[model samples]
Target: MNPQASAQRGSFRHRLVRKKRMANSNEHNAAGYLFIAPWLIGFFLLTLWPIVRSFYLSFTEYSLLEDPTWVGLGNYSEILFKDELFRTSLGVTFTFVVFSVPVKLFCSLMVAMALNKSIRGINFYRTAIYFPSLIGGSIAVSVLWRNMFDLNGYINHVLGWFHIKGVGWLTNPDTSLGTLVLLNAWQFGSTMVIFLAGLKQIPQDLYESAAVDGAGKVRRFFNITLPMLSPVMFFNLVLGVIGSFQMFTSAFVITNGGPVNSTYMYALFLFEKAFKNYQMGYASALAWILLVIIAALTAINFLMSKYWVFYESEGGRAK
Candidate 1:
């Protein structure tokens, strides 16, 4: 064939192939959208709609049975100035978050670090540590916690061995919050798993090099491991703080928010207002307040992370 004829034939074939490829690409894109359509629809309906509705309801008096009444900032003013329980609940929740998040993160990070080392029966140890988190927030676990903290329960029984008399863990206002804080700390396995994943992602070469430079385990941990794991630590810290702020199930089941509302978290307060007292408007306001608090705290965390959290690309060499 002549060169011109050959060139024309090649161009025709290339155009046909391109057209066929484009047609296949369109079919694949359509199929991907079809696969995700249900999820998109459900997300919009269930999550987005409810969020928008809640934001709207926060500005109104919206009882379940009655039409919403435009209340402006009345709910906020009422809760801020008049409602004593709101302040108390917020105080309790803040205390819990402050105590629980740090303690839980520490416990989880320690456990993860231990598990990261070569040890006998490691799988068994990991399973044992992780099992508690699985059942930590269950009704059955709550019930068990209630019993264990009761005056005459197993805690006292164990205390008898040390000749130490047990105080009221669940009943005493001073001790009740402490008991829940401990419970929250004990369920550190989920965070531990995340830390373990972060640890595994850390290259062994970093540690080996640190060791070569005569850095002890503690030195290496402070200098290398902690900085490298800061991202995961920050993630768990935020989640733990949020979860602690909304703590309800344990308090609800174990203490019912008291001997004197000592263990009442924000979620329990909101629940009581919404359902038990039938103060839906007040509860919605409380929910919005909680969201604002969480958002503020999360924002603060992100801001502080800029100072403390060392990402790999941010002049921190992760081997």
Candidate 2:
């Protein structure tokens, strides 16, 4: 072949190879997207679209029966300035989050520490402990809780064995919210599992070294275990706070936001407004307010974490 012809033929072959590789890459990308299309569609339609719509509706006045009328912060103004129930619900929700999150995290961590040990039937124990979380938030469980806390229910009947008169746990405003907090703390199984995983990840050498230095079990836990587990703790804390703030099922099904609305969670209030009263716009406003509150609280947690949440990658506290 002539030298110019040979060069031209080689160039054409190189371009053809490149084009074929590009086509294969595009095909792979398309297939990957096709596999995830369902998730993407559900996320946009079910999650993101509702979020955007709710934000728009927050500024309007709408009952389900009629079209939404733009009211320009009227809903927000009423909620902030005019709604006593809003304040009560906000306080109750905050109280629940404050009381439940720490106790639940602590109980979960304590149980996790115990379960981390090598023992007979450990697998069975772990499974048993975790089973509660799987059904904790279900309507069935909420109904069960309601029944158990009733004035003459199983819980009070059990207390009768000790000759202790059962207080009206679900009836009295003083103890109504406390009962929910206890219920929340009781469902610490998922957090326990996470803590167990984190505990396993801590190096055995750290504990051994601490012991060599005459560190007691408590000392080692404080010095070696907790710092190492700080990242996991931080994760659980944020999630627990967010989850507690959005508590609804128990309040709705069990307490019905009753005992003088003492257990009226912010979520339950928003639900009542939207569903029962048909105040869709007002409910949307409440929802947006909650979203902002959760976001702000999470941001605060992140900001504060730098001082406390230790990561091994940073050699101690996270930067």
Candidate 3:
């Protein structure tokens, strides 16, 4: 073949290859967008729109049936001063978050660590540990929790064997919040699974190297495991705090936020305002306030994490 003709043929083949690669890239991009479109639309319609409307409604007195009356900061003022129950609810919610988040995160991390072993029947163990989270917050589970904490319940039944006197786990105001905190702590399976996945991602060579350096298990965990797992820990911590702050279903079902309103969480307060008292606008304001508080707390956590949360690539350097 002539040299010029051969060169022209090669150029044509290269152009065709480039065109095919471009077409394949466009196809992948289209598919990626298509896969995410449903979630995007759902977020805009159900989440984004409601959030925007709620913020507006926070400044208005809007019964569902009637037009919203502009109330400016009246709702905020009432909540801040006039409403004693609101203050109590805030205190209860804060207490719940303060106690539950750390306990739940710790429990989750421990369980995850236990599960991150080369044991036989690992899947079975995982399933058993995770089963509680699956049925958690259900009406049946709440009923069981109520019974388990009741006077002369299974807990008391077991305590009798040990000759320990039964304390009111759910009935007494002093004990009710603690019972709810325990319940919250028990459902750490989802966080545990997340942690386990994070643990699995850590290279085994690091642990081996640490062992070679004569670091004990505790030292390795503190120096290597915790640092490598910090991102997941941070995620679980933030989520646990948010979930604890919004705790309502268990309190509603088990105690009805009763025993002197000891278990009255913020979401329960909002529910009572919106549905029981027909104060949708006030409830919306509370919801927005809760959102602001959560956002602030999460932001603080993220900022503080820079000091302690070790990344894998951080080379064991303390911030």
Candidate 4:
């Protein structure tokens, strides 16, 4: 063949291959979209759309029964400046977060340490410990908790067996919040599992070396185990804070914001504003305010994590 004809033939073959490649890419893209279509549909319809609509509605006064009336900053102004219940609920939520997160984390960590041991019947023990987390937030547990804290419930009944008078745990303002905190603490099963996993990842050689250096259990935990587990602890701390802040079911079912509003969580307050009083706009505003609070706290955790959270991959130096 002539030289020009040879070059032309080569160019034609290149274009043919490019077209075939493009066709395969298109097929793959179509298949991927097909596979993900359900998730995409649910995300937009169930999650994203509702989020955007609620944000828009936050500035409007709407009863679900009527067209939304735009109110600009009126709802926010009222929540921040005029609403006494908002402040009370926020205080209660803050108190819960402060108490519940630490207690839950402590219980989780201690239980995790216990479960990390190579003991007989360990699997059964894990299942038993973790079972409560599966139904910890359910209405059933909340109702049971309500009865258990009632003046004549199982807890008081048991106390009576000891010849001790059981005060009204859920009815007294001083003790109502404590019951909720204890309930929250009881749900440490999930956190404990995560902590157990983290514990398994820690190198036993480190503990052995610490023991060689005359470090007791307490010192080894503080210097070696704690430093090694700091990243996991940071993760658990952030999650605990967020979850405690949003606790609703227990307070709603057990206390109903009673006992002088001692257990009035922010979520319960939002629920009443939206469902009970039909203040949809107010509730939306409250939701966004909650988002901002959670975001700010999460940001703070991330910022402070640099000081404490240790990673082994930071070039042999603490990160």
| Highest-TM-score candidate | 1
Against the true structure, what is each candidate's TM-score?
0.89, 0.88, 0.87, 0.87
lDDT, model 2, position 77: 95
Could you tell me how far off, in angstroms, the CA of residue 319 lies in candidate 2 after the best superposition?
Answer: 18
* Per-residue lDDT over 137-249 for candidate 2, one digit per residue giving the tens place of the 0 to 100 score: 89999888888988988999999999988988999899999999998898999999999999999989878987999999889988888989999999999999999999988
Q: Tell me the TM-score of model 2.
A: 0.88
Sort every candidate by lDDT, greatest first: 4, 2, 3, 1
lDDT of 3 by residue, 32-91 (tens): 889999998999999999999999999999878999999999999999889888888999
Off by over 4 Å in 2: 1-27, 316-319
1-319 in candidate 4: lDDT tens per residue?
9999999998888567555334444667778989999999999999999999999999999999999999999999999999999999999999999999999899999999999999999999999999989998899999888888899888999998899998899999999999999998988999999999999999888899889999999999998888889989999999999988898888988889988999999999999999999999989999999999999999999999998888888744343
The candidate with the higher TM-score, 2 or 3, is 2
Q: Measured by TM-score, how close is model 1 to the native structure?
A: 0.89
Model 2, residue pairs in steric clash: none
Superior by lDDT: candidate 2 or candidate 3: 2
Worst 10 residues of 3 by lDDT: 17-26
- lDDT score for residue 158 of model 3: 93
Query: Quick one: how many clashes does candidate 3 have?
Result: 0
The per-residue C-alpha lDDT of model 4 at residue 202 equals 91
